[model samples]
Target: MGRSFEDARRWMQEGTKAFLDAIGLLHGDDWDAPSGLPSWTRRHLVAHIAANADAVGNLVHWAATGEETPMYSSPEARAEGIEKGTRMSGGELLAWVRDSAEKLEAGMAGLTVDQWQTTVVTAQGRTVPATETPWMRDREIWVHLVDLATSTAFADLPEDFLEALRADVADKRGEVPEVFGTLADVTAYLAGRPYDNVALANGEPAPDLGPWL
Candidate 1:
């Protein structure tokens, strides 16, 4: 089995390539098009993905240094950071995202394999091991890639990451209401849905997902 760090790096790189390819398909005229992420345009989704690469980088830094680091010290600052990054022109935005992802990959690669198992306290107060950070990175890239509104679909996500995600969601199955149906149903049901709306899927959405759709 591939280690979590290896899985995360591979998936993150795959996602970045997909994101870039999707962005390349967009012309300036298409910037106004709707992304699958409701209320945000394609530009907004791309910018958010780029910003999150850095955010994941922050988490990695915390784990590597065993120091307390805050990407945005306050909720207001966090909002401002996203708003500012999202407002950049398409070329600038994509460049920033691409560059940041490269930097992040390099940073992640520098960590000792043993560091992958070291536990750390996140800015949110939850304790997690370094190994799980790749899962976090994978989720960000894979979900936002869909939110970017590419035709890639959830089924296109790597099997390793999807299976890991299926397992992760299963682990939290209790926290998610039973209305979403079976674990696989919940997995498929939550596709393209935002995290904040996850609770809603537990009921009306009937979470239906498979390779076909």
Candidate 2:
């Protein structure tokens, strides 16, 4: 079955705590070290996640008030926010993450069910109901947690969530090949993420995937 707003709410609430805990493990040199993605250090990853919260919150605000606020004022402003975040110290960055996430949580909590069904545009320009906002944040929290390559990995995600991710990736691609593997392996392959527990299915190397959605 597909997920609902309540499920997405649960995901955001639980996942945010775990994501914050995972990030809390990074220290001095660890923050400066490279993350799972090239050209992005751990600090950059932290900053991006923090900025994403506000961006997603913008959708919630639009839904509640029927305003036409885009996720960012402009593409350049988005990049600038992330760049500015990188300048913060570790303690400051952590606080920003906490504050921004809490602010989003409050916005989601204050919204009515009618407001949730109202349409809003995502950062990528797809128009979806406000209910999708929570799932969007859920994707960011879980995916980026693993991207940090700290105490989390693709295998750590629940099978159901992995299936959802796989479905999403396949949907985004229009069509995905039939690959028989564990949900984690299949999801990792489709999402262009790495998995420590990955196994080759029948000696065939997995097909190269594009950038992660």
Candidate 3:
């Protein structure tokens, strides 16, 4: 059978739990440390995750109400939210994480099967079914968990997910080079993440990877 919203939602739930689990282990001072992403501290990564939940909730809202809602208020709103989040106290930041997730949960509260068929535009302008919402949030949660730099790596994610991610990145980044390794390693290289698990067949540094959304 084809995948349903419930299927995607399950992935979302699992990923969210994992994200929170990683954060639960953080030391009080770890928030100030640098993340896997360059120039972004753990504070920035956490804020971005929280802000992303809210943004995905906007898409859910659009689907449920059939209203024209874009993911962000404007192009700058995402950056603004992250910056604002970074400045928040630890407790406040955690609150936003919990509450913003509820925004998505509540928005998806009573979606009918038909509503799941509603068309929505992604932040990248791709028109997709409403069913894609949870998966969007799902991918963000899992991928950014690595950015937290708390011993979580792309190598730790599911093999199926890494393969799916490879296809996704390859589509966005035309003319991808072949890389061989565990699914996670190849996925990391394809997603433009820092990767050491892969190398050129001739032992040269591989070309830069495509920037994943």
Candidate 4:
């Protein structure tokens, strides 16, 4: 069975902590080092993670008030926020990350059982239950943790969490082709693996251009 909101909240908390642990691996010269992600340095990735947490927290604010609010005034403003956050010292970056994470944690903890099923529209314009927010939160941390290129890998992830991730990945079997050709082509597509011009094992060649992660 899929996880309940509490289950997902606990999972997200643990996952974010694990990600923070891995952040220590990037120090000094490593801050500007490239993670496997083509365009993002380690610092840039951390900034993005922090900004996303704040954005999600904004949604929590909206859910609390029953009023729809945009997390950022504009896409350009969001990009500017990320860029500004990226300029902070590593210590400062960690602090920013910790603060936003706490905001998210507190928000999730405040919800009652009934609130889990409450419907809400996402920043992406996707309509889903408020309970489902933790799943998305987990994805941001879990995927970016790997993007850091740490020795830790998803194999060490909780089996239940992996099962959750597997279902999520499977759900995106069709969308992966929006970038790559097909499911067979991008084994770890949803897991944030890049398509390298290889044939997929199950799906056929895609006709559309692959978008950036």
User: Who wins the lDDT comparison?
Assistant: 2
Q: Whole-model Cα lDDT per candidate?
A: 0.67, 0.85, 0.82, 0.72
lDDT of 2: 0.85
Q: How many residue pairs in model 1 have overlapping backbones?
A: 1
Give per-residue CA lDDT, model 3, range 17-62, as digits (tens).
7888887776678888898888999989899999999898888888
Q: List the residue pairs that clash in candidate 4.
A: 179-210, 181-206, 184-200, 184-201, 184-202, 185-200
Q: Which residue pairs does candidate 1 place in steric collision?
A: 189-207
Model 2, 48-126: lDDT tens digits are 9999999999998999999888999997988998898889999899999999999999999999979989999987889
Per-residue error (Å), model 1, residue 125 = 2.9
Residue-level lDDT tens digits of model 4 in 1-213: 486666788889998999888886668877788876788888888998898888887777666667776666676877887799778999899888888998888987787666556667776778887777888888778767867876655556676776677566757654544434333233345455644454445556534333323
Clashing pairs in 2: none
User: How many residue pairs clash in all the candidates, one count each?
Assistant: 1, 0, 0, 6
Q: lDDT for model 1, on a 0 to 1 scale?
A: 0.67
Off by over 4 Å in 2: 196-203
As for lDDT, the candidate ahead, 2 or 4, is 2
Best by TM-score: 2
TM-score of 3: 0.91
> Which lDDT value does model 3 have at 147?
77
